[model samples]
Target: SGSFVVAVDTDVMGRGSEELGKTLMKGFLFAVSQLPSLPKTVLFYNGGAHLTCQGSASLEDINALADKGVDIRTCGTCLNFYGLTDKLEVGSVTNMYEIVETLAQAGKVVKP
Candidate 1:
């Protein structure tokens, strides 16, 4: 199939205060969702795992991606470490094995 995979490395969009960082992250995801062709997968890891769970400002956009047939996967270990395992909403909980495999097999791996 013709698809791209995007990996999110951190919860915040860029470097700065937590509040500003979160705002940027939300804007980024929302913008991505508006693209005519969405990514096939969106992998969330590290601090980025927080963006797929409950209470995330970007939850609506992320859920829209899921509805559009994107595979939204969040790292299980990261979620547990962050004490957010129970908060996951829009995606599957994935382990490191799957994460590495998904990235390795993606047509394109965009980190943002």
Candidate 2:
């Protein structure tokens, strides 16, 4: 099987009101989690770091992916920059090298 990756670089799915964007994002992750073919990994970076942190509405969905063996990784630099270092809720901290390598090795990459 060709394993894919999900890279989320922002908390919102698109440009617009933050509130609505977040709702869309939550729906997106939920849908992803229910996919018949699960992804190999889900990478969170930049503003997307918020999705893996405490108080994030997407935690349940993200955690569901994790329970199914999805590798959830958050950019260490981004988490620190966002002051969410201690708030990471569902993944391990990752570096640029690992991020690049994971993407490079993936059969396909999905970003949303």
Q: Weakest 10 consecutive residues, lDDT, candidate 1?
A: 1-10
Which tens-of-lDDT digit does each residue in 1-112 have in candidate 2? 2399999999999888989999999999999999999999999999999999999999999999999888999999999999999999997999999999999999999987
Q: Which candidate is the best by TM-score?
A: 2
Which residue pairs in candidate 1 collide? none
Task: Tell me the TM-score of each prediction against the true structure.
Answer: 0.92, 0.96
Worst 10 residues of 2 by lDDT: 1-10
| Candidate with best lDDT | 2
Which regions of candidate 2 are displaced past 4 Å?
none
Instruction: Give the Cα lDDT of each candidate.
Output: 0.88, 0.94
